[model samples]
Target: MTTRAFCLEPEQLDWCARLRTLAAERFRPLAEHGADGRLNRPLLAALGTERGLLDRVFPPDGTAASALDLCLLRESLAHGCTEAETALALQGLGGSPLAQFGTAGQRERWLPGIAGGRTVVGFALSEPGAGSDAAALELAATPDGGGGWRLTGTKTWISNAPYADVYTVFARTGEAAGARGVTAFLVPGDRAGLTGEPLEMLSPHPIGTLRFDEVPVTAADVLGEPGAGFGVAMRTLNLFRPSVGAFAVGMAQSALEAALAHADRRTAFGGRLRDMQSVAHQLAEMATRTEAARLLVHAAAAAYDRGDDGIARRAAMAKLLATETAQYVVDTAVQIHGATALQRGHPLEHLYREVRAPRIYEGATEVQRSIIAKELYR
Candidate 1:
């Protein structure tokens, strides 16, 4: 348990352990005080104030981490508090395009809020009809002819939607089919005709649906080449997919630990649960799968960091295996703990809710298979 994951150096292990301590001692209290299924400003402020984590999300040079470093940060934070890890992850997700592609003024306006944990940022890409099939998104961006555009569409299931300070929005700006018509825009939350309502969801955080009724934007808001925004979106997802797996790995590890602790303590049939062959075998399965998932996550992250070919395939594999494994591990942990784990306030219960969504979001399990298959033939 003391050794760093993936054979990380001692200093790295120590930092992760420190993050876990912070999560249990500081972050957990803040998380507990926040409203369920809503933005937690105080928790965010706490994260912003934590210089070590804040810097991880926004490095001093204002550049982002390699995929491996991102995985480490996410895995460590998730081990302690999934809520804290998610907040940090969302900041990176929503702020990524801005940090990498925004105009100087755009970055100046929003980056500080993001880095300081004072601003919530949204990645507004998914639409009601088009999700995994991102290229088919139909949010229209009509040209106003004066170098601006009027956006008139709805984006659903966006994280941090209503409350975000700014959004990295993708809208269709051309008649070309598929991803060609899309463009990325930096849209401020306060823009005219832009509104949102929170969506009650299985996984808690700040998730909502956004309406852009002629929301106005100028050329200044464009994130990249006018019609190439899909690339921007894909690149961002590619960078994050491995870290998402890392998050899953952390959750699995947490579940395994809980199960191990319970198995050693809970007696059944005149012996501890750990002594029972069935329980021991289940534990073995969970631990082995979790370890294998972690290796896939790290390898995928390393592939991204190296800028290697077939990155899409690698990322898909990582996310696919790790999330599925997490679902199994967490479920097994709950089974081992029995009814106590099902209580609303129980850690396993919370994890049970949290673990189910990663399979559906980002990219579904089926979608990952398609990506891998396409790569295989290509």
Candidate 2:
């Protein structure tokens, strides 16, 4: 039998440790002081300019960061501060299409602000009717006689919406049906007739709904070709999905650590909680599942960096296992901690809220399973 061991190099491990320290010492304070459910410009500027982490996503050399690098970045930061992790991830997600497909003028105009963290960008794809079925987006982009388009529709559940400096907006252009007719545009948030309002979400990240009333966009604003936006979206998602799993793995690891620590110290019936069979077994399960999810996330990211075949299936599996595992581990940790875990400011409580969204965003657990199945048969 051949045994394959998955592991990170000593240097890579050290880098991750440094990232955790940076998040705790530098980013967390800013995140705490910032308003709830809103963008924190100071925290973003630190991640972008001070730490230069955003440069890894939109490098000046035009070389994209490896998928493994992105996964490591997300996981390490998530372990120390989920808010910081979320901010960094949102920057990368919103700006990646521009980096990958924008014209030179677009890149020159927007890349600097994005890297400096002065600009907030949103990926406006999910409409009220098209959250999971993205191809079913109903936002319309009617053509004008002068090589321009007028957008008129709504996009909900958009991160950094209303406050974003710009948005990568997708709208139906009538070239065909479903995804075939969709187009992506780089629309400024201040563009005429563009408006939005913040949403009060469970997770405290800045999410909102955008309403467009015939917002004008010229041909120069298009990302890639007009009818090729879906490909742009898919490529961006493929690169990001594994990192999302990495985020979940980090949260699971944090919860597992808390469970282990609590088990060792807390007193119960005649002894410490670790002495109890039920508590011990629960800790073991949490540890085992967390480790499993971490390894799977790493494997998927490695596959993506290598440009291996069946990336879609691997990415979906990684996200499915890791996010689900995070939810389970966090819930079990909360149970072990008893009433204290449910307190308003408890770490586990915050984690419990944060862990639920990953399974729904990017792609849901059900969606991931479907992708895996389709890929297997293909």
CA-only RMSD, every prediction: 2.7, 1.3
**How well does candidate 2 score on lDDT at residue 270?**
87
**Which ten contiguous residues of candidate 2 have the minimum total lDDT?**
56-65
Compute the lDDT of residue 262 as modeled in candidate 2.
88
How displaced is residue 50 in candidate 2, in Å? 1.0
| Candidate 1 TM-score, C-alpha based | 0.96
Which number leads on lDDT? Answer: 2
Candidate 2 local lDDT, 1-378, one digit each (tens): 998688999999999999999988988888889888888999999999887998888888878768899999999999989999999889899999999999999999999999888899999999999988989999999998899999999999999988999999988988988889989899999999999999998866799999999999999999999988988888889889999999998999888888889889999888999999998999989989988988888999899888899999999999999999999999999999999999988889989989999999998999999999999999
Give candidate 1's whole-model lDDT.
Answer: 0.89
| Per-model CA lDDT versus the true structure | 0.89, 0.92
Q: List model 1 lDDT by residue over 305-329, tens digit each.
A: 7889999999999999999999999
* Model 2, runs deviating above 4 Å: 1-4
Error of 2 at 168 (Å): 0.7
Root mean square deviation (Cα) for candidate 2: 1.3
